[model samples]
Target: MTTPTRARAARRTACAAALLLAVTALPTSTAAATDAASHVEGQLPSGATYMMDVPAAWNGTVLLFSHGYTPAGAPNPAQNGPDAATKALLLDRGYALIGSSYATTGWAVTDAVPDQLATLSVFTDRFGEARRTIAWGRSYGGLVTTAIAERDADRIDGSLSLCGLVHGGVANWNNTLDPVFALKALLAPDADIPLTGLPDQAAATSAANALTAEVDSAQSTAAGRARIALAAALHNIPVWNQPTQERPAADDWDAQQANQYQAVKGLLQIAAFHRRQEAEVRAGGNMSWNTGVDYARLLGRSSVRKEVTELYRKAGLSLRADLATLNRAPRISADPGAVDWMSRTSSFTGKLTKPQLSVHTIGDALVPVQTESALKRAVTAAGSSSLLRQGYVDNAGHCTFSPAEQLAALHTLEDRLTTGKWRGTDADSLNSRAAAADPTTPARYVPYRPTPYLRPYDLAHHSDGQ
Candidate 1:
């Protein structure tokens, strides 16, 4: 971990350049064909349930799947693949798949890893030893996969993540905090909108409704829109919102703000209002704060800074004055215990003990592409860059990759695991491989480099802006 000064310095250095990886094609032996499949389901000692699928003629390779976040008390059903189509395809191709319900669901990282390992043990007890186990996870489960990659690499041959929050829980929450803090500061300064240290869901819901009301009202005026743009900039919310709509043209501030507004609204609907509150409970207190953040500098690093500035200028607003207000606004300080829990449970060392591949849509609103940037930095810092490869899709949603794309990534990891090194995994190669896997499915891999993840937090840089 670097000192606060050094961390901020590193953040600057990272934002100066982006990583634009080119694409390449792939070889398509995802798995060998198999016969009928058998189903297995059971529960762990921790109350988490698990499910598995083993083909009549198995390839001895097990794909250990980890599902994304499920709300607390929700129907925590077990998952053995990304979706039914992919699960069926993998089972048909002779790969055994397994996953668990996890003891509890909201931000279930701690429960997931242990539950997954237990499920694997159960599978081995029932179905016998797998020739090789490949760990795969999505969203928060992606964080679980990376943790497994680091702490339990010897148990798995390779890893794959989809739309994961790899920047760790601290940064993930901080990303949410930036928008809410800014929006509250500028829009509802006197409102009783609670941002952290929530006591229950009732408080969170009430606060969420209040914030949403403010943002909806704020969108109607030029002055209000300017302030919203500032908040969006600090949060690094992307200006391109609609997946089907063309990317907003440069200088189209109105179209851009409209798009950012969608993300802004989404930010309120997601982590800002719910997960942060939920996470505080999980961590035993608040896990996010903004005591020393530099709003102007943060905006400067945003991908949409130019658009924000344009909006502010057109609105005849003072960007400098607003930034000053943000800097001067009362800051939130995280509870030390909560911070410790988040750091220990969700942080990434970037040290990949096994070959890992991750694919994210370029326009992912929730788990932004910037997450990949932080991942690459961490990997590079740990000198594990060779053990990782990332690809981007030309799509614009969270965990939105089609089955073909998902399989293509799996095949790539399989190739690396089978061989002692990686083959073609570039955007072009991934797109081509995905098309080969399923022509009907769209494979929109494209060359992309993401800006540095703003406001990244870890134990080493725990003081963050301070």
Candidate 2:
């Protein structure tokens, strides 16, 4: 069979292995109650209970996962789906799996970590008694995992941040600015108006929503969606195929890759820059042209806090609105644009000083593999470069690894955590398996087209046949 066919087959085999292992992993104590292996419910913190699987004779290596963020009504907001699949895979190998619904639903980090820890504490009290703990989080969860590692290193043994938002603050972390501008740049001819002007919270949201809505509309038409998806595929191919330094914003991305511990100098450089900027702003500085600072002032911290506080109230996320007030400042922005700008190499590089492993699809559109490099850098900087490892998968969606590749990567991580060994990137295994899956057919490399027809990047950026 072709490489793609082989890859798909390997993935299937991996999934089968995980399932088989899960079947045999039930604790002897609960073997008779195998059906009870999963005890799920809502509880303390936010009453956001979870579904979990506890294995027999556990190795005491607990993997706590933090789910990625999506809008409130996202189609498949089920953290349990991936959690269950992963738990079964790991449980069979003598590990326990636990997932927490972060303290809040939105992207704000103020209390998200604390609430997650508290929930973890609850999980520990009830099921796991492991002294060794590893945290795994994706996207938003990845950011929270780093923050937790920074503050509660004593409680965490290691961290695996995947497709995490390592960019500073909530604003820059979301890539609000680039997505808008990129879309505008690419779709200007088709767009009624150029998507520019100051970042008015209302206007920005309106524009994004409008664009997203259009994409959604076009998505209903197979031909249109197919064309748009093709364009997206083309945009990512270059990043995957090009050398790291040759990629867009390579310096920014490389800075992100330097380990936090080893790169104290770099961290200090950026931190000092942030501090200097803060001072200037406090001294009546002009907000940089990039921040759209004037527009930011309109919604500012106070307004965002109120909005988020109320969102928390509605979502049952356990965080105090008073905390928002206490933390409010001009520098404190939750705006997606601001967050994305700052996230490049701020909090993670300075604060994260622990051994960690990160994996990402080279072609990820949301959280670029570049961010994963940043996490690896922080680990290396911490002087524990030996303790960290990275794996890149080919022809994969954001975090969707082919079965064999996923298994190999996880095995590598397990080996590191258990024995402190290093194996080079597992990209080869994944590529091999992916190739095998459908030697003739490609895996899903294209993104979904916008239904209503929003802007997308140009074909020059990626590899799909435009």
Candidate 3:
């Protein structure tokens, strides 16, 4: 999943940045600084357990990072992956590193915060005295981070959400733009209907036959395509069909179970299902891997609601037979009723008066740029747009900070937090202007500039600002 070359490059970049920052901030003849390594493990309020690492020369500041959904019993990916990179970056700067498992993976939100706070409480006791603390997360971790920020503003000094799903239940309840996934969601859940143990050939044959029939009966219309497109966007994947994209296998279906423990995995499972389905179709085999079936089955129903005109049209099927089934929507977990949690209350970006900065990639495939956009809008809506600074990089990936500009952005964030300064970009300016007039208006995001660095560089030679 990672390589030595990339890790080396990241380390060099972070080290150089830390050095520059230290050179400017530290006394020329600095006093001896003590460096120690320690860790703490405990249970969270939500009845979950977590672990954290604190540097010995800690400055009483903490940076708590979160992990997204992963396979059950999987090693915490954040600690060794980006968490290592982040720790190497901040630990040298005198910040204690902390991380927690969110109760169980998938979508379990019940114990998410209690678990995190529990970790924080243990840290406060272990480290003794803290002046500053901030929360940060990626993907589902982002959602967790946001939820924490919303309810525990007093505890969190600042927050950074990266490629996370902040919108909550909306994206899940909806169907994908891919017609196959939409059809798959129409499946009815049955305890007796064993799928995983079936021979691949047999399952493929059954799924393919069902899918083909639906396709033949679908109402091919422009509105139908638009509906499908929306579904695809929700899943963060491209539409499937004539091009033959793959969907994940049956067991992978476990991830799509959105019931608290597997929400993140469920999303990944959906992606895998689509990829596999595409592969199978391309290979001229049965089309058994269907998202529509998974979604419907989860909700305990066999078909989509008739009021879903857009879906029927997109499927391009003869709707006459299923119209009656459609009149009464299937009782499924994917139903809008099952996902009312997102709309229960409008989430605020919180009091934006504090110095804040957001960094994002223009081409991130997983978390759309829209998450940041919504956040910016919320801040602007609160008339605190001036307090936020945003940075975008064209070629970076998730939580990725590769370009010289991104390095500069981190410096900018550090400066704002410690010095109470604020910076602006064209995108930030545009967002501010839009929000000034209508606080409730949505945030408009601009992509990053596209340009390759002209320098032939090594980590030692790289320096943007810090």
The predictions' CA RMSDs to the true structure, in order, are: 13.2, 18.3, 16.3
All candidates: TM-score: 0.90, 0.54, 0.53
Candidate with the greatest lDDT versus the true structure? 1
Better of 1 and 3 by lDDT: 1
Which consecutive 10 residues in model 3 have the weakest lDDT in total? 452-461
What does candidate 2's lDDT look like per residue over 110-180, in tens digits? 54566567666755645534656777777767777777776677777777766565533322322233223
* Candidate 3 structure lDDT: 0.43
Q: Each model's number of backbone clashes?
A: 8, 70, 55
| Candidate 3 local lDDT, 280-383, one digit each (tens) | 33223322222223322222221112223334454565444343233243422222322233333223443454555565654343454445554564555567
Scored against the true structure, residue 122 in model 2 reaches a CA lDDT of 58
Q: Candidate 2: lDDT of 139? A: 70
Per-residue accuracy of model 1 over 1-466 as CA lDDT, tens digit each: 3355554554455446541111111122223222245677878999999998888778879989999988766788998888888787787778889999889879888888999999988876555567789999988889998889988898888999998888888888888888899999999989988888778877888888899899999999998998888888776677775576568788889988888888888778877877777788889998878887888888889877898888899999999998998899999998888988998899877888899998888777788889998888778878889999998888877888888899899999899988988998888888888988878778988889988788876443433622
Decide which is better by TM-score, 1 or 2: 1
> Which candidate number would show the highest TM-score if scored against the true structure?
1
